[model samples]
Structure formats: C-alpha cells, structure tokens
Target: MMLYKLRLTFVLIAIGLNIGVQAQDFIPILKKRAYLNNSYQKLLKVTDTLKIAFIGGSITETNKGWRDQTMQWFASKYPNAKFKQINAGLSGTGSSLGVYRIDEHVLNHQPDLVFIEFAVNDYKASKHHILEAFEGMVLKIKKANPKTDICFIYTFSEAMLESYEKGFYPNSIIAMEEIASHYNISSVNFAPDIIQRIKNKTLAVIGPKQHPDSTYFSSDGVHPYENTGHLYYTQTLTKALDKLLNKGKRFNSKKDIYYSAQLEKAKMTHLETQMFNGIKAEIPPPKFSSLIQNIFALNQVEDLLQIQFKGDRIGFMDIIGPSSGTLKIKIDDQEPQYITRFDRFCSYERLHWFIIDGLAPDIQHSISISLAPNRIDKARILGKATDTEDYKKETWRVGKILMVDK
Candidate 1:
C-alpha cells in the first residue's frame, strides 16, 4: 500500500499548489486600510439600492472603461441587490473643480460610495492646493452623509510610470494619500501592477506603434485604451474590493458600534455645526480667487450678468465647449475687454474658472459681462478645426462669479 499512499500524497500536493496560486491573485494591501465597512454592510443586506458615484477626469469618464466595468461587475456579483451608478466624470478637470461641482453633481444624487480619480489631472496643481481641494471634497461629502463610503483611485500617465518604477508615487498622489489617511478613507492604486506588467513586457504603456505586441495601455500616455488598459484597471479594482469586503476586517462588534456612534456624533458636531458654516461663510485660501455661490446662463449676445462686490479680484466660471463664444467685460465703467471662452481643448463642454486678480480691494467694484458679437477664426484657434460650422452659432454659459476679499 506504499505506492497507493504515494499517489494520494501527490494528488494532495497538486491541490495545495493550485489553492496557493489562487490565493496570490489578490494584490496585497500591506498597511493601507480600506475598511469599506459602510458599503460592505449594504451589499450584505441586498435590500436597498446601492448608489455608487465616480468623479474624475477623462479616465473615469471613458466609455466601457473601468468605471463601467466596475458597475457591471458589482451588478453581477450581487444579483439580488439593486444598484445605481452616477457618472460625474468631467474631462480636463481636477479636484479644485471637483469640490465646486460635487454639490450639484454628486451630493445631490446621495451616493452610497464615491470613487475619486484625479491624480493625473491634478499633477500640475501645487501640493497645497491638492490637499485643500481633496480634503474639501471629503469634508463636503461626509457632511452631506456620514454613512457614504469614499475611495481614492490613482491612475497613471506615461510620465508617471518612471516614478512608479523608481519606487514612488507622483507628488499629487502623495498629497492625496495624506488626505486619505487623515480621513480613514480607502484608496486603490493601479500603478504598481501596471508598471510591473510593463516591466515584464506583457502590457505596453504606449500603443503597438511603440511595442511589437498589440497589447497596450493607451494611444496617448494619459488615457488608457478601453479594452486592454481599462480591463486591467477594472480587474485590479474588483479584486481589491473582493479582498477588502470578503476577507478584510469589518466593523460589526460592540466596540465598533460604540466607535460608530462616537464618529457620527463627532461628525455632526464638527462638520455640521462648524465646518459646513465655515465653507459657506469664507472661501478657502484659493490658488486663484474663490468661486461665488451663483450660476448665470448667458445664452444670447444681448444677455449680460453684472455683479457688485468688494474684493481684490474678480472672475467668472463658464462652461467652455466648441460652441462657447467670447465675452466682453467692463469693470466700473472702464474700457471693455474681450475674452474668448473657447480654447484648443474645448472639443467638449467642461466647467472652467478664471480670475482677474490685482483689482482694487475694499471699494465696491461693478463688473458686467455680455456676449461679444465678433466671429472667432476657428482655423486659427483650434488648428485644423473639425466643426467650423458649429463655431458660427456660438453661445456663452457662465456658472459662478469668482472673487477674493481684501
């Protein structure tokens, strides 16, 4: 029977090896904490609709990308549960713009979970602005609903791949990590795995033009290809979620109950009573001037928006798009100056804010803006303009007025 025992041992060993390989599928979290307790509880119940919101730049906004795939995976994973997904992704925008838009775009929907991706877009912003803006978003979300879960997602640009290879995140991501740690929020970073794949020659950072194999991340270094790169991103995120929700420690004990009660009390006291009012009363020390709490739509050339305020600076936030036209602005009877709303990147509509600083402070200043009657040279502005005909019917849509106190 020694031969029979030997065969049984080999079978058991093969089974053990298979189990070990399956176990390695999840990327290690190490010390990074992503409880995801609130959403986990909701998924377990499978009773109510779970609303998930994604807010970022073009990466999150792309069709059939990680955002869509993740939503589909969630639906399939929890077939009994109802799910609602909110897409608040805007192209060429960062956290500074995100905080302003969150109230109307995200918080209004009241999502159960929010996935924030802005590392690549916010790369150019100062570390201080990144911190302020990201923290502002967290505070605003928590203030709106304490139970809502938030996850910070960090995606990469080709320029960033070198940094990841050298064993570090870009500066913007570092700032975001600080905010995430401070708030006890979780984050999913796709950089390490993607970088590893690139190193192994399995995944190309650029396209087939650069690499021999057709497998690639993106044509442009910034946005990932919907099929290959986005699939990798979705796989990494879903696997992390599986590990975090299924194997990670959850908050379901007496001690956790007490902790949750205290946390809610603290949030109510500090966020509702103090922080929320502070945000409304005073603008955060801005990189530029702060946005005014109003939106005006200037649809026609005759349409005008005028505001009188005491501040050192003045500006307006507008929806910039292919059809956006120039505006004529007059400050306190001064000669009117023309400003074009369209730019090289205005192929699509996006919320854009500008500031005219160094204005006279302490005294009330009158500023009026009306659509200009001038026809802009699309060929000159856009360089090989695709929609020259559309540019003929230009419209102006302004969002908020920006100002800074003396």
Candidate 2:
C-alpha cells in the first residue's frame, strides 16, 4: 500500500508537470539559483517581541491587512511582549509591485520580522518574472537589513482544487518551502492548511461542495473573509518569530537599493498580469465604440449622452471602464455644452473614456482634451513591438501609444 501510494504521488506530480509549465509566481518550476523572496535563507538572528510586517495582495488585505490577528496572537501568548505590526497590503496588487515598495512599506521601517503573501494573486504577476520580483524584494531586505527575519506565506485561490486537478496553493508552497529550506528562514503553507484540514475532516470544507462559503479561517471565495484566517497564519508566524529572536546575528549595511521605476510598474496589477507571459484572460473593455475619442475618468461625473453635438455632428464613444467620463463642445465661455456618461458601467463596462470625432474637421475650431480621448485618430502602432532578440514571441512588450500629429 505504501508503494502504491508513492506511485500515485508520482503520477500526480507528472500530471501537474505536463501542463507545459510556465514559470509561476505562486509556483516556481524553474530551478533558478535562488528564489525571489528568500526571506529565510540569509540566516539572521534577533530577540524578544520583534516588529512584524505583512505585505501582499487581496489575500493579505482581506482582514484589514492581517495586522489585528498577528498582533492578537502575540498579545495572547507574550502578554508583555514588545512587537510592532505594519500591514502594507493593497487588494488586487501582485507580488511584482509589493516587492517594489518593500523598502518603503517594509525594510525601511527596519522591523525584526516580515510576513509576505503574494502567492494567490499570481494570476496578476509576470509569468516567469515573478521570481525575480519576489527574489529582488527578499534579497534586498536580507542584504540591506539582515537582522530582519522573513516568512514567505503562500495563499490560494478557493476555486482552484475544484477545477479538474489543479490546486493553486500546493505547488507554490512547494516552491517556497524549497527556498525556506535553502535560506533556513521559517515559512507557512497557509492555504494548504485549510485544504488538508478539510481532507482530514479536521476543518470543515468552506463555501460550497469543493469551496467553502465560510471557513473557520475564510470567508467569501478568494480572500479570507474573516478574522480567523489571519489568526490561523499568525500562529505560524509567532512560532517562527520566537526562534529568530532567540538567535543573535546582524547583517552589515550595504545600502543595496534593489528597486527601480520598472519595479514601480509591479504595483499595478494590470501590468503584472500582462507580464504573466501566458494566454492570460484578455481584459476586454466595453464593446461600445466610436470613431473618435474616449475618456474614462469622470470623478463625480454621471450619466447623459457620452457624445452629442448641437452645432456639429453626433456619434458614440467607446465606454472602456467605470469612471467620470464626459464630452464637452464649445459654445461660448461659460455655456459650452457638456454631456456626462454617468454610472452606466455598473451594468455595462463603465465607459469613462470617449471617442469624439468632431467630423467638423475644426481641428482648429478646436477641441480640448480633458482626458486623452478613447481616440484612434491620435493612436498608432509605433512598430512591430514584439521581441526579435529570440524566436519566442514576447507578449509583455506593449505597442507604443503615440499621438499622431494631424
């Protein structure tokens, strides 16, 4: 039976690997020299009630950033222990960006501890590049401030296991575990704990049959919709912290500034998802299109004809996504006619941007842009923007959005 189980495990691993494995942030298949966030590897030591900072995406942001739970866990045990909690989590953010702001949100504060979680949202991270981003953040933290101990927590997508045979958090935990062992930093497989708990009947399944609607540790579908989920991980962190503080060591100050403007792009989930280098879900904007300009932000702006002209022509503009999108035509100084495309995308894709073709050719009579119009007239393909360096087509490189001078 043991041999049979081993054979079954081998089959499972083989099935998982056959998916033409792309480098994943949540799951590192690539045998690179080291992991992006090697918090445990640097081998640091510290003492009592260390300040702990947790950073990541929605999973991290779920319960007001998991700060409360982490603190509560310590408060219960240490009672008189000294500790600081900083939650630098923003929902919808990917690891690429979290790694960018580590200096600001994490390292600079010089906490003795940090809890990083960017695994679940790997959907929004750069395909093969997540490791570098994660690696960069951890290496930066360790190299500049080695005294700080790190915990790389892998989160999960609730619906993951239900789909065929793909389980999101397990492989990611595997990859992170590999890093933790190499660096000798403490780690936690947060998501899998709940999953395995349910398997063993120790923890009831959450949400639905495959997914739990509510967990002793989670709520909703993706983010842990409760305080308990945070508490769950906090226990693991507390144990890890005790060991690090007990050890006594410090890293020399190298002032290794490891991030850049490019890294800043990581903060934006859209950019990171594009970097996934996979057949990612195309974020299709609203179908509503016009032959002219489109504006996406209305800022308190609301519903009306997105595009209508009295002294000129009439047409519609593409309503991309929700925001305060409006169109204005000049009549005089105080009386220029204005149309606001209000909260429409609540049902449709909130059209904040518009395509306005004066059709009057009054390019001089003239048009002023509040927001760059959802304009094709101004947009042109800069070049064959794909990478020519290698045979493989690189999807990340964007087609430049250049303004065409009429």
Candidate 3:
C-alpha cells in the first residue's frame, strides 16, 4: 500500500526527530581561503553591468538559492552585461531581520554586488546577536552605498560541522573574518567550501551527516539545491568572483595573496515565489456608495466588472479581459495558487504590490483576476493608454465595476 504509506511517513518524521530543541552552536563556515584568492582595487570599480545581491536567511531564497546558477553564470559571461539579481532572503530571517530590511531590501535595489548569507541563523540569536546584526548589515551598506560591493557568506549546517570544535564555536566565523578584515570585504566560506569539496573527493553526495540533504538544499534545511546548487555557485561563487573580476589593486596583495578569473555557469531562473510578488494592498479609495470605473485596457474583452469585500478576508475582484496576463485565483475546486491572503489584496508584478500569503475565508469564494499562464511579468487590462497612470486603461467602462459584499 504505497510501501505502507511510505513507512508510516518515515515513522512520523522519525518521531519528529526525537522531541527536543535548544542546541544551536558551532557556526564556523568561515575561512575564505586566505582572503579568498583575491585582487581588485585599482580605484575599486568593476561593472560592465551587474546588480548582484543575495542577502540571507532561508539561504538567500529566490528560486531557492545559488540563484539559478548565478543567472546561468551571468548569461554566459556578460552577454551584453545587465545581470541583475535580487533575493533579499526572508524565511525565519536573522541578522536582526536583515537589519530591518536593509533600507527597503538592500538600499532600494541599487546593488553592484552583495552575497551575505547569515552564519547559520545568526548563531541562532547570540554570538553577540550575530555580531550586532552583522555590524548593522555591514554598516548600513557601507553608509548608504559607497559603490556597493560587499560579500561575506559563511553558511554552515551539517550541524555546522558537528559543532566545529566548539568554544562559542568559531565566534560567528571569527567575527566575520574580523569584519572582512576591517572592511575590505569579500569572503565566502560556503560551509567550509562545501566541506573541502566533500573531503577532496571532489563533491558528490551529502545529506544527514547532520543535515543538508534534500539533495543538498531546497525544501529548507537552509536553501540551495537550486538546480544542483549552480554547480556549487560555479565552483564556489564564480571561482571567487573570477579572482575579483579583471583585477587591479592590492587584494591579499601580501605574498600568496593575488589572483585571476574563470567562470562559466548561467541560465538562471530561480523562482521560489513571492517578494512583493506581483502586488496588492487594502485598496480603500472609494466610498459614499462607492463606484469608480477607470477602464484602462483588456484586449481579451470580458468587460464589465465590479467587486467589494471587507475586513477579515473575503473575495470577488475580477478584471477578466484585455489579457496581458497573470491574474491567478480562479479556484472553483482548487488549483489556482490557492487564493488567500484573507483572499488577495496583492499580486500585481510590474507596478509592484505583492501582499500575498493569504486565502481561506470563502465568502462564497469565486475570486477572479483571470488570464495567467505566463506572459513574462505583467498584469494588464489590454494596454491602450492615452495618459494619466494606467491600471487597466480602457476596457470595462460601463457602470465602472464594483461589488460590495460583507
């Protein structure tokens, strides 16, 4: 009987892993192989176009880490360089909620490079509150973006090397390698370089020697298995960012401390889903009997719409027509992103407004936004604009669409 219900769900998740809790320690995922074989600083600048950012917690969540093999290794080496990446990881966040949304997710997406994976849940809230919230997210992104570039990833979890020879255990990767050597920043001891590439056997097989098995990541246990961890981030983070891309000035420039670049891996599409996903809000702008119609566009034409639901969740907001795509939530018997954020007040994409994480409060649930099965990233009303802000520019223009259900 399906192998006896998968061996009774693995003996009830191995008796919920032998009932216990509190233990967290041994945080050493640090060592950045002597300043990670480096170079770069002839007036510190390297950008033919790159917006790289990963943040941390839930292992840099986005398509579940190693971000689609660092976007297929920057579209096969800067194919017209415009490789932008953003994950702002947020799943049981640490580093004190990534220093309260590091200025709305890494200084409002103005990244040049940032791959800071928090040392295993900020040493589970200690190790001096993960070095005072990671020196306040690297001194507030170097005092508000000083040519943005900061890398400090020290991700360990194979019970962080069976409590890496404990002492307060590698004090948050030796206080983040002494704050990336007092701020020259750029480091990535990715779990001891994947456990010395799995003890020199050149990587292959790991999981439950302490925890990392989901074939090494994704599905939690701290995220990554994103398509084979992007060849382990193109052989350890693009071979340490190709020895600091087209090098120049003194990096580890002190004997046995200089470098070069060579990387190949990309095709990146990591989409775990939701980070202002689409977009939505409480939507409270009409009243006094409320009814406003500002038809913008909708070429698929199912026109004439209206909706109104209040408080503790309800549904009914359809804009069925002029399909540009992505409306999700047509659940009649399931299979529709299971609509619920008390029933969606968000998911708008391009114009940005994802308030999702909802559903379940039927109100006779028939919520419809229709048409969606990929059209890139859009929420359209048939795009036929003539002026003044569009959100469905001009299609369902009869009595202007509105429905109030309490």
Which candidate number would show the highest lDDT if scored against the true structure?
A: 1
How high is each candidate's TM-score? 0.71, 0.49, 0.24
- Candidate 2 residue 112 C-alpha distance from true site, Å: 1.4
Clashes of each: 0, 40, 43
Best-to-worst ranking by lDDT: 1, 3, 2
Give the per-residue lDDT of model 3 (tens digit) for 1-406.
0011111000011321111111232222222333321212312334444667788765666563575576677568655455667767654446544654555566677776677877766664544445555665666665565556677876655555544423223456656555566556656565544544554555444443234433443333454565554356445666656555554432332222111100001011111112122332223234201211222332342421223233223222223322223445443365666321111212221111122214453444443443333442223222334233333332211112111123
User: lDDT of candidate 2 vs native?
Assistant: 0.42
Candidate 1 yields a Cα-based lDDT of 0.67
Q: Please list the residue runs of candidate 3 whose C-alpha ends up more than 4 Å from where it truly belongs after superposition.
A: 1-54, 60-88, 91-102, 106-149, 154-184, 195-197, 200-280, 283-406
Q: Write the per-residue lDDT of candidate 2 for residues 1-406, one digit (tens) a residue.
A: 0010111011112422221122233322212222223223322212444567888866675564355666676667565556677767655556645654566567667776677787676544333345555656666667656656666776655554442124323333434444454555455444444455455565543443234443444545565545455555555445444454343333323433323222322221112223222322233333322111222222221211121122222222233322323445442233455544433222223222222333443333333223223321111122232222221211111111111112
What candidate 2 gets wrong by more than 4 Å, as runs, is 1-49, 64-66, 162-184, 201-217, 236-245, 248-321, 324-372, 375-406
Give the Å shift of residue 135 in candidate 3. 21
TM-score of 3: 0.24
What is residue 196's positional error in candidate 2, in angstroms? Answer: 1.9
* Better structure of 1 and 2 per TM-score: 1
Stretches of candidate 1 off by over 4 Å are 1-31, 208-212, 246-303, 309-317, 325-339, 347-351, 355-366, 371-378, 385-387, 392-395, 399-406
**lDDT tens digits, residue span 93-137, model 1:** 787667656776788899988999999998878776678668767
